[model samples]
Target chain A: MNDGTSATVTEIDMRNTSLRDLNRQLHEATSGHFVVTNPRGAHAVAAGIDSDIVVELRGSVGYYAAGMLQRGTVIVDGNAGTGVAENMMSGVARVTGSATMSAGATGCGGLLVIEGGAGARCGISMKGLDIVVGGDIGHMGAFMAQAGNLVVLGDADHHLGDSIYEADLFVRGDVASLGADCEEKEMSAEDVDLLTQLLERAQMTADPGDFRHFGSARQLYNFHPDDINSEVAEARS
Target chain B: MTGENWHQRESYTFDRNVIAEIHRAANTGIYRIRGFGAKRRLPTFDDLVFLGASMSRYPLEGYREDCGTDVIIGEGRAERPVHLDIPITIAGMSFGSLSAQAKEALGRGANAAGTSTTTGDGGMTPEERGHSKTLVYQYLPSRYGMNPDDIRKADAIEVVVGQGAKPGGGGMLLGQKITERVAEMRTLPEGIDQRSACRHPDWTGPDDLEIKILELREIVGWQVPVYVKIGAARPFYDTALAVKAGADAVVVDGMQGGTAATQDVFIEHVGIPTIAAVPEAVRAMKELGAHRDVKLIVAGGIRTGADVAKALALGADAVSLGTAALIAIGDNSPSLEDQYQALGTTAGCWEDYQDGTDPAGITTQDPELSARLDPVVAGRRLANYLQVLTLEVQTLARANGKSHVHNLEPDDLAALTVEAAAMAKVPLAGTSWIPGMG
Candidate 1:
């Protein structure tokens, strides 16, 4: 049906739907197998998809998959490339396998769940997204997160929540070290509740009691050389 | 030791003789002069604007009134949209010409003013990006730091065709400023003089430029607005071409604009004055039926609120500062008089930007010179200058019985001289005399 507003679900599968075509169809269509096959590390797969539609990728996807997504469910059957669900405003992006670097980076609002480990710079500059990883994440995870909940099940690499601002970070394993402006804060009951909720949303089985919260120390934003020098002197002392 | 002292003294005398000879040769047309053009004589773009107060335009009661200077360029439909709080912005002074510290100071100042600063022929720096809330990345013909990631990171993209100081000429970053990092960003050999290509490598004309814009828009996903910046030559044609090429805004830089390095002949002789360019650009936009719809930003000899008001009145949506912003950040502060003397120049009046011998550490690559400037303090000074400019513009607008600065019209302007009247295309003061007409 060539109606201005509607398209058939079968129409998507019949054509050699490129990533651009699929994205355009997803933007225009209300419901659609929307099968994206032959995805040879294609980027921005299912990007700008707003409607309540389901998109299935037959193979691995590339960077910024489902970027800036809103109000839809995106299911990736295989491993996802870098920046999966980046800057996503709202919706659910579920990856069945491991994710590459910068998963859910700068996602303002959404639920992103990675079943396996994420690469370096995971959730770097994340603003207000809920990221749950089932396995170990690489170094510099949750860097500069202003406001969001990041739940990691495995050991985090060095500089977790580096220079972060206000985003709640809950990690189950050992952290190598905190970056500048990031500090380890004791987990409270409310934090545990939030962690538990994130776990349940990601369908994770990890216990919330094993997690620790990390946040910004509120330093670096206001720079006073004298205060910094004194702190440096105190460290020497 | 005596012999060494004798040799040192002799060498000093010899060096002075050589310099004198060089100067003589330059004046006599023996040695071909290259770079350091417009900086030789007359007041720079920084000299005209002086901060005025309640006596001239109603000065803000300091903390009582809300004087807003925030402006958003290339917003809504362009490839990249930049949201800035202040109207004053740093003009494009390339990376190869300025030290990293100078660029950083520019960013710090612009950021403090809640405005955006631009990257020059050099690529984007982490320090500049981190400091600035909104950064407009330059896409010059040289493509020094042209990469998809930097373009995506930028709040707005400026496609620079030419500069006011030296139109149709390439940029040269001397070997002195070509530090390891600058070389790396530009992909040039370290310790070697780098010359940027005069024309863009990817595109040649407006038709191709439109495609290039589309490519950039596609890569950045059309979030940030794209601005096409041109030197004020053929303002009507260039402005129309830029608008036709899908530029969200067109920035017209006049002959009075500053450059880090350019041949003396080109700076003084080439390009039209900003006063003349503004009206032509606005006329082009009006003819295209996109006068205010597509933003027109004018830069060249824009110093004070009066100059800014004049530009807006003649049809510029906003004004950008290069030399003036640099001065506000302590480019030639009188406190560095001793250093200026040592450089054989005076503070508040040095223009040998090409020699890489700036005393304020603004235009030099020398580590000792660069370390003189502190980015934090410089940024604060720039913020103060921007605040003063906003207040002055607001005051002038009030005097003209206008609410917003953008509401000012050509009716508010009266040219002081016949030349100014002809050049500005406005009526003469105390008369109905309009130049270029009987």
Candidate 2:
């Protein structure tokens, strides 16, 4: 629901302008489909972006691109650096290329879709954000992830889902190792359906059956005196 | 043996507390984690005496005189620097260690007192943001709840390099205090011990820190002031470095500063006393030709208005409060003596914040315990305490024959102890003898 009609497009050349001035202009300009040309891997290119508008950045961007976006859609045509869509409240931050570390980190509500691979700690400590990575994710990808769905259609790296909380993981590839307190769980029909929906949202062709679910067993959620007893009992059995 | 009464008791070097600590360490096989500041005695503001106007100068009327107590920090650097009615500010205390209600109380109290409240390690909370007139968001090592939106919402950004209790060490939020909300905010599991990293992930040195500072300014449109906070171990060097890195204000927290949880060894072993730190920080700024240019805000163990006066006299622009603010909000009240005894501690000696069983509801995350502290009442109490502190400072300023509190210089002070005189770099009472004079 931008002030400018979907037919109209506003083009901005970012070569001469400073990042602060560019972001300020975006914040001040009420609403529009802003087309940014020649980003050239600039950091926080459209950071703290608010307003119900669409931003189409032409090329690769540096760290914190589209960070803290609220009620808008940011489509990065190329690769994104660290902390893409970080702490986003509500919106869509879609990167057509791969992303660096901590993508969608601490995001409460949003849809972050990466069409390619993601670097280390991809969804670390996510909160209620759905992150869809079309390719592999690096080591400790979902470490301490609290909530939300992390869907990876390709492979995942070492120590996946280490010390994760209530966040659900859907992976379709082999993992190297697992971290403490994380466990693989059986994927139900509901899990497949969710994966199917996410894949469709990311505009990718992938089989839902190829995905496996991972989550926390919640055993280490609380400290108890009877923990030793449970461990000993399992050992005996 | 023949004269039992004549025999000296246990050696002072190996006191009961020392012996107990040895035994406790032997049994636990781990360092003791606790809250509060150093329990041992050290030279402090108590060792400093004021030269009340007596002979040559005349004392202003306590009730009628116009003694200014207002201070302006970040005067020129920031597009909008906070103009405080009083020099005392509420220091950073995390939401995880403290209840949301407690954080809200700090905000309300600071707002009422016309001072800024800091958002501590865990990130900014909505309650704090909504209640506080001026909120300083901490960019800590952990980056737990860091977001550009919250950063933009903040009035200031304090890049936390170190804390007073554990200068080189990171912070800890024990599992018992990590409730659902805290866990979600930190992106850790509920009821799991969260250990913050000691160093920032992006930058390793001061040169890199300079870049990080610029990046932060870029994020906020260069409107809010950037503050750099460091423990008071190397105040002279650290203050100079922070200024070089483009900080509008520098916060130097002394060793007596309180913490939510840290090793007992670290609390007592690290950092310098507040009495010593203020002068060093001031000296650094003065040497670098940025004395008043970059505002110096000191913290740690500041309780009384006289302490505030002494700090200002020693060249601190402002003072921040942590433990004293919590006490004002009803932590460790003598009324909770029964509860303290039940928890195997005394009222004023309570320090087990890691256990999450705070009787005063100021530290715990329990719903019932947290609800016990009403934000409105606590805020009013804090405001009342701040008013007294401001009035006392004004009274001292009037007595010193100075129109403004900042006008009271080191000349107005005299030390009562050799250690205090040496540490504070001030002359002894009725004598020109300054112990550490160069």
Candidate 3:
């Protein structure tokens, strides 16, 4: 087992060993992709990895497939379970298939790409990261995004970009309604170029021309007494 | 209008010459005031905590014998959880609001009592950190005096989301109190009104707060425990979120808490009472399956030992004191009645912390006024009060068959009045009434 004292790659056969042993081996291995084949559904397969290594899970995995990843690439070949790629930082996490709700919730920085659909609150409160979802995202996507870029090829759910600030959003499909302080902005050539690069990085073939951008209008930063009085008066009326 | 009432109301009138003479007797400089300064009858935090041991309950020996009062906060998960010798900790009252001597005195008292003192919105002061054995460094939304060096130096980190005195509101320090040093610490212009941002500059909700926590952990290499301090609003949701965000402990401050300077309207009408907030926070911890695993520190209106015992019985791991600690260090004492009167207010009833007209020298920048307070004597008084509180809590705990003060449960408590019972979430007298019971 690599206990942070050594920098070496140690491989183990997933067929002969359990998911727990595989994860342990992967955690111990230094800076290389540990290939896994025919992996049955397993929970917490690769949790708390803090090294620059890659783990390629060949088959579908259970809940929290790549939870609390600090650095490294964790690629799930098939569909993943709940909290897939949760709180990942400074690495590329590419999920080939659909992910459950709360995907990439509170990710500080890193590139998380979902080839298939993602459930509710995708990229919620994403800070300084780039999330590219090829398929549609469920409700409350990019809610309270402080700073990041969320590019969705398909339609976005309700309350998209709620209470967002400075974060860039590009979606090709219909947006139900923009959240408070979030307004639609004209997409420029520079924006198109950025989208093209993001798509290439995420390994998606979506057209940048079809996408629309949304961002914060910068209201509600400071409260005004007149606004509160008006609201109270309206309630009274 | 009655004849008998009219006869009883017969009065004498003073001579016009005598009135003129009295008016002429009044001096022009600092002598025109009638009463003490700031005579408003505002309620302090101590007004809420009534002593519990009266006639029915058994009380322990005040001296000799052991009534343990030590507390382990942020244990297990926090990189550095503080182990205090006493339950009563000093609250975060800023350096700008109080003089350097006052801060030093508070630290000295807390150190003597084997507890910790907190740094406030202005940031860590050398006097506070030097005197305090255990010091809690506060990380406010403003990021004032925030750096990696201070984070590493702190015994614990308290992320202040809000305070009970003004839950949804930010802080405002007027120009009068912002000394050069205070201005330097907060990175603001000297002698100008400073308003701290209510929301955090870097993070939003608990979801993003996790990242901030991780960053702090990385910076400090996870040596000290992280505590999330929130004003008592929706205690259930806030507490649950704090725990979910990987906090080692949660500090829940109730409405009656004192502020160095806040609007009177916000202080009187902003948040829930301290007595009501404790049980709700305890319930939230229980719901998250982190009741005792994650420590709960309750504040606001915590005064004497009986109040400490009652709070512990109601499921608080420990209690913190601010105004009471200040009082023990000679704030609003009757001895300062002359100075208070000169300022048009009375001792034991002053709240003009926003104005720099303090007489006891505790909360002013004027060198002469601040020099009136002796840090060594004030520190001794505060230590004595802390000792009393520890003994009092221990006495009640022993009577209830609890070896340690933390072991006192709700069963050991009974409310005197319906209001007290409802507020404390305990059973009424001569009845089995538990609010959290399913």
Best-matching candidate per TM-score = 2
For B121-186, candidate 3 gives per-residue lDDT tens digits of: 877877788988899998876555654456668999899999977797777677777778887776
lDDT of candidate 1 over B240-307, digit per residue (tens): 99999999889999888888766666788888888888889998999999888788999988888788
Q: Each predicted complex: what DockQ?
A: 0.02, 0.22, 0.03
lDDT of 2 by residue, A1-237 (tens): 234545468777789877777787777656788889999988878877777788899999987787767778999999998778877778899999999888887677789999999998888767678999999999988777778899998899999988787899999898877776788999999888888888888788988898889998777564434344456678999
Q: Across residues B48-164, which tens digit of lDDT does each residue of candidate 2 receive? A: 988989897778888887888776766676677878888899999999999999999999999899999999889998888999999999998777788778998988999999998
Between candidates 1 and 2, the one scoring higher on TM-score is: 2
Candidate 2 CAPRI classification by DockQ: incorrect
Candidate 2, DockQ score (0 to 1) = 0.22
* Candidate 3 off by > 4 Å: A1-237, B1-65, B433-438
Q: What share of the true interface contacts does candidate 2 keep?
A: 0.24
Q: Candidate 1: deviation at residue A172, Å?
A: 61
Provide the overall lDDT of each model, using Cα atoms, as 2-decimal numbers.
0.75, 0.86, 0.75
lDDT of candidate 1 over A3-101, digit per residue (tens): 334434433431365554566566676665466666766667777676677677767877667766766878787898767876676789989889987
Fnat by candidate, in order = 0.00, 0.24, 0.00
Best candidate, lDDT-wise?
2
Q: What is the TM-score of chain B alone in each candidate?
A: 0.87, 0.97, 0.86
Q: Where does candidate 1 chain A have its weakest 10-residue lDDT segment?
A: A1-10
